[model samples]
Structures are given as structure tokens and as C-alpha cells.
Target: MGKRFENKVVVITGAGGVLCNAFAAAFAEEGAKVALLDINEEAVMQNARMLTEKGCTAKGYKADVLDQESLKQTRERVNADLGTCDILINGAGGNNKRATTDNEFHDFDLPEDTKTFFDLDKSGFEFVFNLNFLGTVIPTQVFAADMMGKKGANIINISSMNAFTPLTKIPAYSGAKAAVSNLTQWLAVYFSKTGIRCNAIAPGFLVSNQNRALLFDADGKPTARTEKILRNTPMGRFGEADELLGGLFFLADEQQSSFVNGVILPIDGGFSAYSGV
Candidate 1:
């Protein structure tokens, strides 16, 4: 592979999971010094070790995106180990089961066993909202400081298709991701003069541990929910984690996307565009 990011320092939050782990490897493969940040120390450390074994410049740091002080410590560690960051990927976010509805649609009259909109827990909703929204904001607040006034510095956010269209049963995630997309635009304008660009990637359904329960049956076959998703998606398949790498690498590359800003690039296999007509 070519050294597009030779000597460039990339920081990725939520690097413990499948998506961000792939991101860490991809950036490192392109000759960038990648710092993997995650609240899960064991997983992040394992990923960092794996990348190092592959001869990629990488290190893992424990960081909670929700805590500013924790991020400060992480920033210090990253700066010391990998130099000031050139790219920041805010990827730490997930849905809470407590915040998700049990059923896809609400009925006029519901049973107590069912988690309808009326019975949704306020604390659960708040946790989900804060995890996805504040998760991005806090990390940006801490990590973006390193890129201030630095030429070609960029920020890439992780949004979802649900941000554009509220999917059934995940109202909190949909709303929080929408906030991320909106904040991306606001920050782009706010930092226009700093030569720093901000953009987001709204990914389609990817088969990962997060949603595997809903998508796969006991025998490792596709569930009814998976069929529905594929039917709505024009491409008739789920995207792979590595599929997101190209869009991410393009947005990270200043030449390809220097003029691009505040755009929510969708890599959803046309799932966001299909009208279900």
C-alpha cells in the first residue's frame, strides 16, 4: 500500500469494537500512526497489539467519550506517543436495550409487558442520547484542540441512516445520530477559517455483534428482520465493515475531499434512498 498518511497521526475513539478496529487497521495500513481510544481497555489493548504485530504504528489508550477529564488524560497519552493528531474519528456510540422498544410499532392499546412509547423509561432514553451525542461532542472538545490552526486537519464523525430516517424501535439512537449530523455542520462552519474540515459517514446496516441478535437466527441463518432490511435496501445485502474504509480514507485524504465539508456521506447500499414503494 502507498503511504498516503505517512507520519500522520490518526485518533479513533471507540476502537474496541469491530467497526473502529477495522478503521484503526486501515489507517495504520496506510502508514499513519493510529491511536486507538476506547473505554474497554482489554479489547483496545488487544487490537493495538495485533496491529503492532502487523508492523503498524499503533497504541491503545483507555478513554470514556462521556468524560472530559478522562479524554484529557487520553489526549496527553496520544500526544506523547503518536504526536499531535491530524485526524479525529468520533466513533464511540451504541444503542441501549433499555432505550430500545420491544416492538416495531406502537398500538393504540398496549400490554404492560410490551415496551411502548408511553412506557419507555426516561433514564434509559437519556443514557442512549448522551452516549451517541455527547460521546462525539466531548471527544471533539478534547481531541480537536490538537488540530486547532493546524493545516489539513479534519474530523470524521460516525452517523447512521437512522439519523436521516427514524427506524422502528430505536427512537433514541435515531435522534442522537441526527444530533451528530447536525453538529457536524455547525462545527464545520464554526471552524471554517482554521483549515479544518468536518464531515460524517452515515453507514447502512452492517452485520456486527451490536445487531447480530436481531439479524441472525439460532442456526446462523438470516432472520425475518434481516429479510426486511434487505428488501428495503436496493443492493439486497448488508455492508461489510471494510466497505466503510474507502469512504473514511477518502474523507481523510485532504486532496480528494479538501473542498468537501459538512456533507453526510451515505454508504448505505441505497437503503436510505429506497422509498419502499
Candidate 2:
């Protein structure tokens, strides 16, 4: 059988991460001309090279989504090299250490020596907010410009489980992803007349470099948080990267999801629906 995205032009941000890297490679294998964008030039290039070696049309570009000029330049290069972008995957987002609290609660009566909510760094909060929120906005502005009025144009934002319900200790990441979900709805309405569809995927727990330590111990045993996550998830395990590709390809192909817009699909193995019993 033929691939769903054959001969399409697809752009993915944060292409160096495990999830987005999987996205990039999968799209390439399906015969899409993949543009892998990431701040880590070497990592993005390596992934692109691997795809090319397997006879896929793939290219890597180092650009920060926070920088509009860099994203604009990347958009230009992608258009010149791979034709206009029909699919955009906004995958460039993560939590920073500063934005996280040492613990979930604040003891007002506790002494100042303890790390509490009062001890949370403002700079850390801002960093996560900007990276997760502005990162999505700027890239959408820059790349979606190439998709205006084009056939099969779609934008897929990478939201998180925190968007639906705030997670502990990571206020900034949670709130920012919430905003991403809101923006997805807003853009879908805004672009409805222009033939562009905007949607998002809210991924649940997945073991990646960003949270490997938090989810597992040095001996590779599941941590308390990981166990809690599994207990709360109806499927009882972390999701695999490839599991998201079906939703991705569905949103990317207009014929498959032509009327779907403003939807935030949760690829969370039932985590979003389950409650701990």
C-alpha cells in the first residue's frame, strides 16, 4: 500500500528530541520531504543524514523557534529546497529546571531555609513560559505563512497532559501548554476561511532524555512519580513515540481529517481519561 504522506512537504520543530526525531523519520519513510529543525544543529543533521541514507528526502536546519528571523530564514530555505510546506509540526517545547519547584507544596510556617514556593525563581518560570508558548507562536507565524490557501495545509502543535490538568511542581510548563491548546483552537477558527487547519496533540508520559531521571532511578527502576503515572493511566505504561504517528498522519492528510479542526487529541494511553482508584 502507498503511504499517506507521500510527496508531501512536512516541517517538524525540536527534531532532535526522541519524539520529534521519530516523527521526522516516520514522515520521511512515508515519502514526505522532511525538514528537521532544531537548535542542536549536530543532532538534527545526524537524523537528517540517517533519513537520506535510507533514500528519503530529508534536510536539517538549525533554527530557534523563539527567533522569528531565524525561523523566517528557515521557511525561505525550505520553500526553495522542498517546495511550499503543507504540514507543520510544532514540536519545539520542554520544561526548564528553573521553572520547576523542588516540591509541590508551600509551607508558609516553614523557615526560610527550606526550598518552598517562595523560593521559586522568577527567571525559571519565564524561561519555560517563553520556550513553550512563544516558541509555538513564532514558528507558526513564520512557517504557516507558506501554507496560506494551499491545499492540504495543516498545523499540528505539540501540547501536553498538563494543559488539561495542571501537574505538580511545573507550573510554567503546565500553563504554557494550556495556552498552546488555546492557541490551537484560536488559530483553527482564524484560519478556517483560508483552508488551513490547526490542531494539537497532547502527549502523555513518554520516557525521554528530558525526564528520564525523574521517571527512573540509576538502576533503571521506575521512580515514585513513574509508578504514580502508571497507576493513573488506564493503560498502565508510558507511551511509545511511534504511537503518536497515526494521529500525526491523520491531521497532516487533508483527505483523512479534512473537517477536523480545533481538536486537541490526547495520545496519552488513557491517562487523560483515567482517575486513580
Best by TM-score: 1
> Residues 44-113, candidate 2, lDDT per residue (tens digit)?
9999999999999999999898999988889999999998888999999999877777666676576556
Model 1 regions more than 4 Å off: 109-112
TM-score, predicted candidate 2 vs. hidden true structure: 0.96
In angstroms, the error of model 1 at 249 is 0.8
Per-residue CA lDDT of model 1 for 1-277, tens digit only, reads: 5698988999999999999999999999989999999999999999999999999999999889999998898899889998999999999999988788878877767766987777778998999999899999999999888898887799999999999999888888999999999999998999888888999999999998999988998899998889999999999999999899989989999979999999899999999899998
Clashes of 1: 0
Worst 10 residues of 1 by lDDT: 103-112
- Where is the poorest 10-residue window by lDDT in model 2? 108-117
Indicate the TM-score of model 1: 0.97
Number of the top candidate by lDDT? 1
- Quantify all predictions' global Cα lDDT against the true fold: 0.92, 0.91
lDDT of 1: 0.92
